[model samples]
Target: LLSIVDKLSGDSGIGRTLRLAYDFRNAAAYLKYLWFSGEGEFKSFLPWGTLEPDALRGEIENILNEQSTDIEPALAGAVEQARHLKDAYKTPLAVDIALDRAYYRYAARNLPEGEYFSRWMAVMSDWANLKSFVRVINFGLNRKLFWETFAEGGDIPAGKFKEAIDLDTDSIPAVFIHTEYGSRLSDVIKTALGGEMSGLDLFFRAKLMELYRYTRYCIFGPELLWAYAMTKQEEINTLRVILRAKGAKLPFEMIREVISVVLE
Candidate 1:
């Protein structure tokens, strides 16, 4: 990327464009490191020694401010959607549904609303309906009870789990992060959805990438858009690791540790 920028230095107009391109590319690399590395290393990789949630929120705000200038039409709609998210809806599931709606509406506006879009819209609707039926009885916030309940594959005792839990027991998507094209996770989603599922790591990264691609032209875009857009190859690499561990039916502790690391 640096080389690409250097090669364009002689042309003033192109040089400025190349510089921004390089900055975006480098930012992506750092984002990848955050998702793929362990918590300790991720801390070491940052100046503040932590992936502060507030910092993330601030950074996103900054980006939106800049985007308002770079692309006013796109950013304006995004801001309105974000406003709706903040003042009205408070739950993750609610936020997710709103984003999905904004994304599909944006897609319909830009695309021909072909069969592909129709199918995905249906799938998204089904997922939303399933989310509504998720049994979210309160499980106490104790770590032991939380882990035990998750392991037992049943509802947690009152006060053990999060109040807004939306973990669907019937249709959990698993990504086989380590496996190749013929691997279980990739093949299943690919056959079911029908798309360019190859080249995907078929784990968290693949799921995220699908979200990113679907919503790139949307009004509000995805919440993880920055992380998804920035971290390309390396982000998917760690996803493969998580999927492989899952497929092996490893102990819950082992799987949880890997997931916590990836999502940190």
Candidate 2:
């Protein structure tokens, strides 16, 4: 996997940022795993390639203090910018938008290998935008603040996402009807209205997996590499979520909803 990341990330700092994103993910999962075991279901996914759960080092938040030197830097700049925006806006939403934009922008740039992979990045962006729009409506977020989260490189128009804020549930899906998510927007809206915001995220996640599953038969190419990476990340993410929810003792329905996505 490291070799694959290295091969794909050879384009500027984008590849390095990809590794850094994994570092953050693994570290976060390790910490949560520790919290669950009070020190240890998660043994397999806890790769510990970076986290060092037994070392008991300082908090992983320290990753935020990393310097972005030209010789070696990942998503540090993006992380720092997100931190700044978080402080300025007094909302975590800024951080979410900033990091996501950086990750996608870099991922899209790094994958010059195939247009299909590039389109994957674009669809992922659309999902992010669509999900953010759902959150804006559900949480009553500031109208102007939603624009800050708008990302480029997606089929969906920025204006369409902007117009969705004033829309009710019945009317929101129509805004995206002409775009990549036209057929799926209905379910996105239905799941959002079903009262579980997490479900909306899972809905898109399942779509990405569906999108990539067809490429597995490819004997060779960056597409296969991406498929494997996406599948692995899906495992890590799903397990991480289930473990956290279990550790927190959330309801079974919540876990079941997420598990269903993975099962599909």
The top-ranked prediction according to TM-score is 2
Tens digit per residue, CA lDDT, model 1, 105-184: 44334433344444444443333222222312222222332222132111222222233233332222233223222345
Q: How does each model score on TM-score?
A: 0.31, 0.68
Question: What lDDT tens digits, residue by residue, belong to model 2 across residues 1-264?
Answer: 655666764543334544655444443344344333445244433332333433212333454546223311334555556666656555555556666666676666656456677678777887777776776676666766567767787788888876766777777766666766666766667668555677568767887888678786766566766676777777877898888998999987867767766565
Go through the candidates in order and give each one's C-alpha lDDT.
0.36, 0.62
Question: What stretches of model 2 exceed 4 Å from their correct place?
Answer: 1-18, 23-74, 168-170, 193-195, 217-219, 236-256
Shift of residue 40 alpha carbon in model 1, Å: 14
Clashing pairs in 2: 9-15
Candidate 1 Cα lDDT to native:
0.36
* Per-prediction CA RMSD (Å): 15.0, 6.4
Model 1 off-target regions past 4 Å?
1-68, 72-76, 132-264
| TM-score for candidate 1, residues paired by index | 0.31
Instruction: Report the lDDT of model 2 for residue 176.
Output: 67
